[model samples]
Each structure stands twice: as structure tokens, then as C-alpha cells.
Target: MTDSGEKESAESMLAEIEKKITDAFEIFDHEANKTVDVREIGTIVRSLGCCPSEGELHDMLAEIEEEEPTGYIRFEKFLPMMTHVLMERRYKPSPEDQLLRAFEVLDQDKKGCLSQEEITKYMTEEGEPFTQEEMDEFLSAAVDPDRGVVLYKDYVSLMAIEET
Candidate 1:
């Protein structure tokens, strides 16, 4: 693409991202404050399919606050964070790293493996709750029956196989 063409594409992408951020803030800003709170930030990030660690979330909120020091995130502060996340997602980690990160989010107890109950609860909590059949199928495919838990390695391997 020519320089002008590239610039236009970049502008178009930015505009689309801005629209999406606006729509997301509207839905997740529970207090109608026109700013996104910390809790809302977590929900928004998860809804976007990224599982950031607690520390990472805190850092993101802090980074946003550095400019304005508001407890909540206005669009100007929110845009850069959203852009960073979008870039990270576009250049995703390896499948193993992705699975490990996901497992860390799901393993609420830090047990290094996910219990069936934990998986079910986490999946259900996401806006579109998983059905019993879907959960069962996932367990059958991802869980280790002997251990009765979903190990990170096993889950990663299962996903790798599925992609083939």
C-alpha cells in the first residue's frame, strides 16, 4: 500500500476502534457516570476475551489515572488502553502461553489446575452462560478423569490438537 493508502487505513481502523470503545463504555458503565470504574474495567477486559492478572489490571488503571487522576476512566484515557490491548491481541502469544494465562484466571485458588466446578462457574459468569451439555463436552475434551482436574499442559495440548 502507498503511504497515503496506509494512512487512510490507519485512520479508518482508529475510527472503528473509537466506535467500539464508545459502545463498550455505554454498556459496562453501570453507574451512568460517563466514565468506566475499576470493576467495569475488569468486566470489559474479560468481555473482550483477555484475562489480565490482578496486578496487570491495577497497573492499567493506574496508568490511566496518571494523566487525570480520576478514579474512573474517561474516553481519552480509555482509548490508549484499548489500543494497547487490541495490539496485544493482534500479536497474540503462543497457544501454550495463552492457555497458561487463561488457566491462571480460571484457577481462582491458585491450585495449578482447574476443578470442574470452578470451570463451570467461571464460564457461567461470563454474560453468555455455558449450558450443561456444553460444559460436559468441554470437560470430556479438556479434563483429566484420573486427576479430576484440568491441568494447564493437558488443556494446551488439547487445544493444539483441535487446531490441527
Candidate 2:
């Protein structure tokens, strides 16, 4: 496709995203004022199924405050920033299918569960490598002492429930 065509496609996508963000903004902007409390930004983004960490959300808010420090964001000012954020996929949770696939790789015997040792190794040695404390916290929630294994499918389901 020509450069102009690609540009047009990108613009079209941005418009669609802008529409969605505007709708969400209106969900909180009940006065129809085209502005929302800056603090509500996190809730809005999460409602759209994005999972930016608190630090990341703070960074996003910082960029906004650099432009306008009113403790609120107007739609006109918010659209471009939010469009860039969503387009860039700055922060997104791992999809459930990917989580299940990772567990599948560790299951070896297709048991839909992982031995305590297997999970420990993966958490401590894999990409980004969780700290012992982080792994311990996760284990405390996911493991039942008597089982000696994490039923990852059930664990993931619980995570989904907690999210909702």
C-alpha cells in the first residue's frame, strides 16, 4: 500500500480508538463536560482491559500533567495521548491462552498442573525472574500445602474471577 494509504489506515484506527475512549470518558463524565478526574484514569484504562502497573499509570499521568495540571483531563487533550497509549500497547496483561500454554509446556505429562519444583524453577529462572518474595507470595495464593502441585487451570480461573 502507498504511504498515504497507510497513513489513512492509521488515522482511521485512531478515530475508532478515540471514539471508544470518548465513550468511556462519558461513562464518568456524567455532566457531559468532556473532562474526567485524573485519578479516575486508572479505573478507565483498566475497564478497557489494559493492565498498566501503578508506576506506569503514574508515568502516563505525569505526561498529561506536564501539559495540563488541572487535576482533570479534557477529551480534546486526552484523545491523542490515549490513542498513542493504546496503539503502543504500553502495558497489557498476558492473555489467558498464553498463560495456559505456558502451563502446558511445564505440565510435561499433560496434567494441567505443575509440581512445586517445576513452578519454582520457572519463576526463579525464567525471563525477568521473579524475586523469592514475589514467588513466595504467588505460591502462597496458588499452592495448597497438601497438594504439592499448583492446579494452574484453577489458579488462572481464580485470577479471572478476581479481575472481574
Q: Write the per-residue lDDT of candidate 1 for residues 1-164, one digit (tens) a residue.
A: 57898889988987876677677778977777677765678667655545566566777778776465656777677777877786556322246667678779777778888888788888778756667876888888888879988786667764542221
Q: Deviation in angstroms for 88 in model 1?
A: 4.6
Best by TM-score: 2
lDDT of each: 0.71, 0.79
Candidate 2 residue-wise lDDT, 1-164, digit = tens = 56898999988988888888888888988678888888889878876667777678888788766354888877776777788888886566776777778788888899878887899998889775667876888899999678878999978765542332
RMSD of each: 9.1, 7.3
In candidate 2, position 46 carries an lDDT of 75
Model 1 lowest lDDT segment of ten: 155-164
TM-score: model 1 vs. ground truth: 0.53
Residue 106 lDDT, candidate 2, scale 0-100: 83
TM-score, prediction 2: 0.57
